[model samples]
Target: MERLKQITSLASLAVFRELYNSQTDIYAIISRFLNEIISTNGKYNFTLTEITNLLNDSFGFTIPEAVVSTSLGRLDHITKERDIFSVDKEFERTSNDVSSLKDMSLQKSSDIVDGLINYIEKKKTYV
Candidate 1:
C-alpha cells in the first residue's frame, strides 16, 4: 500500500509538471507566432482557427480550439473583432532577449496551472 501510494503521488506530480510545461510551450509558441506575423506584415490579423491550425501543425499535436482561444484571450495585445483577432500595432517586441520571453511564459504557465487547481478544488467542494 505504501509503495502504491508513493507511485501514485509521483505520477500525479509528473502529470502536473507536464501540464505546466505544455502550457508554457503553448504560450511561447503563440507569442512567437504573433511576433512573426507582425514582423513580416507590420500587422497581425488572424482568427482562432488560424492560430489553432498553426499550433497543431507546428507541434504535430491536436490542440483544442478552446485552449488556443483562452491563451489568446490572456494576451494583452490581442484584440477580438467578431471572429477575427488582431494584435496591437504598437506592441512590438523591444528586446531580443529569449530569457525574458521564457520567464514571462513560465509565469503565465504557472498562473494557468494554479487557476486550474483552484477551479478543481472549488468544484470538489460543491460535489
Candidate 2:
C-alpha cells in the first residue's frame, strides 16, 4: 500500500509538471502568433487564406486555416474596443487596430495578468 501510494504521488507530480510545461508552451506560441499578426497587419485583408499563409510563414506553425481564423476571431473579441468590422452591409477589415499595435508597445506583465483574468472570466461564464 505504501509503495502504491508513493508511485501514485510521483506519477501525479510528473503529470502536473507536464501539464504546466504544455501550458507554458501554448502561451508562448499564442504570444508569438500575436506578434506575427501585429507585424504583418497590412499584408492581408479579412480573408483567412491569406492570414493562414502569413502565420505559417512567420511562425512555422502551419496551423490550420480554421484555427487561425478562430484565433483571429478571439483577438477581435478581446480588442472589441477597436471597430475592426464596420457595420456596413459588406464586412470590411478596418486598419485602425493594425496601426495601433505598431505604435504601441506591449507590457508583458500586464498582458499576462489580463489574459489570466480573461481566461478565468471566460471559464466562469461558460462553466
Candidate 3:
C-alpha cells in the first residue's frame, strides 16, 4: 500500500510536469517563471536582456528582449526600475489564489488520488 501511494504520487507529478511543459502562452509562461524565481530567491530583479536569456535557456524559446519588455509592461504585478524589473509582493499574494485551468486540473487529480488512497486505507482497516 505504501508503494502504491508512492507510485500514485510519482504518476501525478509526472502528469503535472507534462501539462506544464505543454503550456504555450508566452505571458503565462513568463509570469510563472518569474513567480518561481521570486519564490526561490525572495525577489525578482532582472533586466530585459537577462530575462530574455533566461527564458530562452529555460524554455528553449528565442524570445526577443522587446517582447520581454512588453510583457513586463503588461503585467500589473511587475514594476520597472531603470533597467531592472521586479514583482509586487501584494499582487503576488493575490495572484496565488487565482487558479488557471491547468492548476485546477492538477489539483483535482491530486484530490482524487488522495481520496482513493484514503478509501483503500479504510478498507484495509475493516478487513
Tell me, by TM-score, which candidate is best. Answer: 1
Query: Could you tell me every candidate's TM-score relative to the true structure?
Result: 0.45, 0.35, 0.44
Cα deviation of 41, candidate 3, in Å: 5.6
C-alpha lDDT values of all predictions: 0.59, 0.46, 0.59
Q: How would you encode candidate 2's per-residue C-alpha lDDT over 1-127 as one tens digit per residue?
A: 5433343334333433444566665444443354446545643234556656765554334578656545665543223224332122232444433233322322333454568879999999987
Choose 2 or 3, whichever is better by TM-score: 3
Q: Total clashes, candidate 3?
A: 0
User: What is the C-alpha lDDT profile of model 3 across 1-127, one tens digit per residue?
Assistant: 6544444444434533654578766566556544544444455577778767765543334567777777667678788988888877675442331124334645665677779989999999999
Could you tell me the lDDT of residue 116 within candidate 3?
95
lDDT of 1: 0.59
- Clash counts per candidate, in order, are 0, 0, 0
Better of 1 and 3 by TM-score: 1
In the order shown, what is each candidate's alpha-carbon RMSD? 14.1, 18.5, 8.8
Model 3 segments more than 4 A misplaced: 1-42, 93-127
